[model samples]
Target: MKAADLFEFPASIPFADFFRADALPWQWIGQIKKALASGFETNVPGSIPPGVRISGEVYIHPSVELPAFCSIEGPAWIGEGAQIRPGAYIRGNVIIGAGSVVGNSCEYKNCLLLEDVQTPHFSYIGDSVLGNGSHLGAGVILSNLRLDQKPVKALVDGKSVDTGLRKFGALVGDQAEVGCNAVLNPGSILGKRSLVGPLTPFKGTLGPNKLLVSKPETSIQER
Candidate 1:
């Protein structure tokens, strides 16, 4: 694999850098598409039945389970063994990865949820990237669009990176855990294995294995 394909992220780039208004222009949906395509063919191959209702172009892998109450809009991919519980709303251009769980009352739009990700309660995720093994606690929410309704951008290493999209949410790295009722603002990021305490409003970049109790008050500790 190409180095660009391996890490798929810029080198030494701060997580907060992904939100700067002047960050480099990156095609996030394209990256997600590439990632899904690189893996298996089905959205939830070997799990979901072909007769399930998929509105629009979608890819599902084997072993995916979609209950009748699940609504799926396409340009979306559901990976192997992923479960879409009842009352889940999955909008277009989202990638739900292998073994992930999208629980009841959860809504996802234009996001990338990597392998083993779980959002097990009332959650709203939009234009976000949830890394492998990440989990969002109950009532967690991510705000992708600014209230002013301007385009979203990313900051990388102090440089501005444009996302070229009007809506974009948080980017949670591998194994991150967001606590219940927490809010991840637009362009926020949680580095690998980071933890966010309940009711926290995360507005900036959180480093790898960081423990975030609230905004600007986070610690780095071993799990």
Candidate 2:
């Protein structure tokens, strides 16, 4: 699906020109690096905490709330008013939009987190796009790589389409909610306002405003 279908590309992020609205959603993953390289201006916080280690080309807005301890490796951008909780690990081509929460113990790489996204605890977000207002429950994992190490294919229109990327994760659409301890398999797509129940291992594409629940048996229900 088109990027516009999933994300609005918040105005708070300066690299919007690199991510075209008409482009495919998965295509936006590859643009993360290019976007950072082209427009990123390094502006770190003035008073760095003792336990927080920041390295490489990074930009942390003045209003970003940094925790006491975290490791942030760059080519990364942390937007205004973003909250970086303790023990967070941010590395490589990461973009955190305004007011987003880079939760405690979260590991992020090659990802784009749009405005107001909340990944509030113990999550692994890599090579994925979390849209505006999306929330991930504790221990949510966006599994990026296939076990076989092959290209990740997305399920579009009920057909498998090769995304051509070996490392790809879920495209969590605007305002979506993923429950605690859920594992989103490689190439998963959660449409806008959709919900994935806790403790579920979800894969493929879930449409807008839907709910995927596993009550001993997995089922898709209208939200």
Candidate 3:
């Protein structure tokens, strides 16, 4: 399938140019950091509120809200109306979109969160692009490293295709919902409007309008 089948270009909040994929979609992962840095060339206007520790260079819109204990490392941009709750750590080179929520205990880096995306509560998202309105339930993790610590691969059309990147996380599509405690293995791709059940360890590609549930059936005898 083509890249356009998985991502909706209109849903992108910023850095829309990065979505143009001539070959494989994952090939654009390397360009994310560069795109983020260049956004600052236009004199990005922003302000930093109290109790927030800032390092490097951060471009935060005035309408963004940062609660206490929010630490941001730079080459990062926080969009309008974005909410970074307490204990939210933005490692570096992160693009948090407008009206998005990076909740408490969520650690993310080198990622693009589309508008209205919610990665709240104990989620680890790295080196990935989350589409608009996608939601990661509590304890959901987008894993970036494989066991070998080498380049991650994606299982597309029953083939394991190498992504050629040592650290690459999942590409979650627009309106996808990952249930609580779900772990998305490296190089996973979820198409638009997909659902991942709670406690599932997901890998490979799931097309749009799909529901994946992975849980062992529980049997109760007498109490």
Candidate 4:
């Protein structure tokens, strides 16, 4: 499938021209940081509002609602109407699209969140791309690196395909719903509108419109 097929960019949240390059979705994964740097120099959407603690050259839109005490490093951009709650830490090389939320006590780095996406509450998103309207439930962790610190890989066409990046996280498609406390291992890809059960440990790829449920059988003996 094409990169456009994978990333659902809507009117409310549109990705910059960096994604317009003629490349596949997987090929662009490792190049996100460079793309962000280049975009920061050439074209950044908006301005950083006051009352936010900015350590680096962050580009935040005027319409964004950034609460006080939110820490933002440079090479990052937040779009219009985005909500970054207090204590939300945004590291460098990140792009948060319009109408998104990075809630309190959450941390995200080197990630892209499309418009209307919700990653609210106690989550960690790194080196990943979240599609439009996608919602990551509270306490979800998108694992960006493996234990061995080797290059991350994905299950594509039933084979392990190298992502060529030491730290690569999941690519969640549009409107996908991940339940609370889900752990998305390195190179996980959740297709459009898919549902991941609560507390699921997910790795590899889940196709579009599917339901992944984990029900552990429990014996009800004498209480």
What total of clashing residue pairs does each candidate reach? 29, 0, 0, 0
Cα lDDT, model 1, residue 139: 98
Q: How would you encode candidate 1's per-residue C-alpha lDDT over 1-223 as one tens digit per residue?
A: 1112212342211222232323222345335545434443333334554444567667766466567667788768776678888888888767777788988989988777767888999999987777777899999999887798887766555655666777778878778899999998877767677898999887766667778785466555666
Better of 1 and 2 by lDDT: 2
TM-score of candidate 4 on Cα atoms, chains taken together: 0.87
lDDT of 2 by residue, 130-209 (tens): 99999999999999999999999999999999999999999999999999999999999999999999999998999999
Each prediction's Cα RMSD?
Answer: 6.8, 0.8, 4.7, 5.2
Per-residue accuracy of model 3 over 13-72 as CA lDDT, tens digit each:
467776674546675567679777666732233545676788887777877666867888
Give lDDT tens digits, candidate 4, residues 1-223.
4456567555543345567535556555655577666645323334444656776666777676667667888778788788889889998878888889988889988888888889999999998889888999999999999999999988877888887889888888888888999899998888788888788888988887877867673121211
Q: Using lDDT as the measure, which candidate wins? A: 2
> What's the distance in Å from true for residue 86, model 3?
0.5
TM-score for each of the candidates: 0.75, 0.98, 0.89, 0.87
Backbone clashes in model 4, listed as residue pairs:
none
Candidate 3: Cα lDDT at 109: 89
Clashing pairs in 3: none
Q: What is the lDDT of residue 45 in candidate 2?
A: 79
Candidate 2: C-alpha RMSD to true structure equals: 0.8
